[model samples]
Target: MPIKFEIGDIVHLKKNHPCGGNIFEIMRIGMDFRLRCSTCNKQLWLERTEVERRLRKHFRNDEEIKS
Candidate 1:
């Protein structure tokens, strides 16, 4: 099944970002997705398929607090 995502959701990418962070926040979603790197605060736009392929895991705010 396709993963459900929302704005503000935190996601970990399978590969580390060039900025040395794997964590990102979902900024916008559609045919394309906008992500902001957690460490460097850089923004990136990627296709939904690419994002899904690279997705490692996702954590909501409550879930993040618990971890």
Candidate 2:
């Protein structure tokens, strides 16, 4: 089964962002997803498939969630 995501979730991506941040918060979800980097506070837009593929971890309220 596919992973489920919520709007306010914080996630760690498999790859480091150019800004050297891997932590992000979900801003929008659908065919495309909008994420804001926790370190740089920069927003990114990515496809749902890409988001899932790059997802390394999930978090809520600063705690990690096991998949």
Candidate 3:
């Protein structure tokens, strides 16, 4: 099944940031995904194609937390 991520879902990218973190949070989802670095609070935009290609894993789902 294809992995689907939504806003507020935490994810780990394929590569670590210069700040030594690989984790990010989904801020927006569309043609491009907007992400905020979990460690440094830096915001970045990644194309959906690139996101699917570079996404390493999904961590926490906001929906799951409410249940």
Candidate 4:
């Protein structure tokens, strides 16, 4: 099964970010994705494929979504 994503969803990536956090919030989705680091509040633009590949888990409305 594939993971579904929506704006404002929180995601845990497979690897930690440079800020030492693995969590990020989804900001925008379309041709690319905009994700904000949960720790540093840093926003990054990434391709959809990259986001999907890096994603480990996802949450919506504070509830984890099983994939």
Highest lDDT scorer: 2
Off-target runs (Cα >4 Å) in candidate 2 are: none
Any residue pairs clashing in model 4, and if so which?
Answer: none
Worst 10 residues of 2 by lDDT: 58-67
lDDT of 3 by residue, 1-67 (tens): 4467778888877988789888899999988899999999999998988877787777664433321
Residue range 1-67, candidate 2, lDDT tens digits:
6678889999999999899999899999988999999999999999988988998899887778887
lDDT (CA) per prediction: 0.87, 0.90, 0.80, 0.89
For candidate 1, report its TM-score: 0.87
| C-alpha lDDT of candidate 1 relative to the true structure | 0.87
Which residue pairs show backbone clashes in model 2? Answer: none
Greater TM-score among 2 and 4 belongs to 4
Candidate 2 matches the true fold with a TM-score of 0.87
Models 1 onward score TM values of 0.87, 0.87, 0.79, 0.90
The C-alpha local distance difference test score for the whole of candidate 4 amounts to: 0.89
lDDT of 4 by residue, 1-61 (tens): 4456899999999988898999999999976999999999999998888888988888999
**lDDT for each residue of candidate 1 in 1-67, tens digit (9 for 90 to 100):** 6678889999888988898999999999999999999999999999999998998787887474322
* Shift in Å, residue 37, candidate 4: 0.2
Runs off by more than 4 Å, candidate 1: 64-67
> Which residue ranges in model 4 land beyond 4 Å of their true spot?
none
